[model samples]
Target: MSRSTLWLLFAVLAVAARPAAAAFPADANPDPRSISVSGSAEIKVPPDEVLLSVGVESRAIVLADAKRTNDADVAKALAFLRASGVADKDVQTDYVNIEPRYPYDSGAKVVARLQPEFYVVRKSIGVRLTRVGAYEEVLAGLLANGAQYVHGIEFRTSQLRKHRDAARALAIRAAQEKADALASELGVRRGPVRSVSESYSGGWWRGGSGGWGNVGGGQAMQNVIQQTGDGGNGEDGTLAVGQISVNATVSASFAIE
Candidate 1:
């Protein structure tokens, strides 16, 4: 090859061999001298509302009959709820299931098919009660009206977002406190926070407050307290609406002086 051609080829190869230029600046690693700490805090508040889960199951030899029976039964339950002061807006249908029960013992293969010996229709609903005092009455009435099963009752509050925000602040404060304690133990002064990271959605945390063990460093945890119901007479006596917990965790890195 000619000298000028060889020189041009070498220059082009050199340019291609070089690493591609970055469109944005690369992220620098955090300060090595800084210490990372995580902290969590929780607040306990009395529940202001109760969530009740109720369901109905009906079965029949025909699909139409099964659906009609289920519809009628669910309407009866809904009517009972509305009459008992539950608004339409508060009653929500959670699920509707249509399943077939086959007679495996019969001369039928275990293949998946549409037709079956019997059709079972199931409907589930959620009821939100703002008044905790009406727990017993509602529980009993729901079953009497047509609810075949009562899944559970959980305590909750309307101000969940508000409590979550407060818990986050407490978490940050707890992180600062942890950093300060560690610095003191090492006989080193704690400097300003180098970086802080927090999850907006509080994590599921331990249920209780004031008696917390080593529970922190998570986000968006919900604690559900289930209240069991006995089928006897559907008479769930006055149930207590326990406290609800809001938890938060904060992770921070602070420089050392």
Candidate 2:
């Protein structure tokens, strides 16, 4: 090869071997020093509303007979509820099911392909009571009027949004207080907030065999503070309308100075 051609090839090879430049310099923008903390708060208040799940189940050798019995019982229960001042909008049919019950063999296993012993028809209804005080009376009337199964009862607050907002505000303040306390111990001061995140949960608890239960959507988290209110009871003291808990958690990062 000629000297000029060899020089041109060398130049191409040198260019190909060179490292690429970075898009951003390493020291152009460094991450700020920050302190991360999490805080939570819980607010308890008397429930203003109650939700009840009631159902009726009937069985017979004929499907039509079982369905008829279930329908009549449900109608009676609904009529009783209406008479007790429950509004139409607050009452809804939750579900309806029809299944066959087969006879069990001597070995306790269900017999296959044999004639069904009986047909079962079940219907469930949801009732929302705006007046928390009338829970006992309404429940008794439901049972007397043919509501056979009590699936569950949930006590809740109508002002859930207001209480949740208040809880979130308290949680943020708690986070700020924690950051300040930590900074004071380290002989540093907390600066402007750099990042923030939050989560929340709400639920109810009963006094009997059943324990804590979730009423709606939300994940459980640690609570920093808890307060309990009066267990709302009726004049006869048959039912206890316990307070509901609204909880919130906040995670925040603040600059350290």
Judging by TM-score against the true structure, name the best candidate: 2
Q: Model 1: clashing residue pairs? A: 202-219, 202-220, 203-219, 203-220, 203-221, 204-220, 204-221
Cα distance off (Å), candidate 2, residue 30: 3.3
TM-score against native, each model: 0.70, 0.78
Residue 180 displacement in candidate 2 (angstroms): 0.6
Q: Count the backbone clashes (under 3 Å) in each candidate.
A: 7, 0
* Stretches of model 1 off by over 4 angstroms after superposition: 1-31, 106-115, 200-237
**Candidate 2 lDDT score at position 48:** 82
lDDT of 1 by residue, 77-144 (tens): 89999999998999998888898887655655557343688998888778988776676687678777
Range of the 10 consecutive residues with the lowest summed lDDT in candidate 1:
210-219
Cα error of candidate 1 at position 70, Å: 1.5
Over 207-248, each residue of candidate 2 has an lDDT whose tens digit, in order, gives 221211331221121111124447555557445565778999
Which candidate has the top score in lDDT?
2
TM-score, cand. 2: 0.78
Regions more than 4 Å wrong, model 2: 1-28, 106-112, 203-231
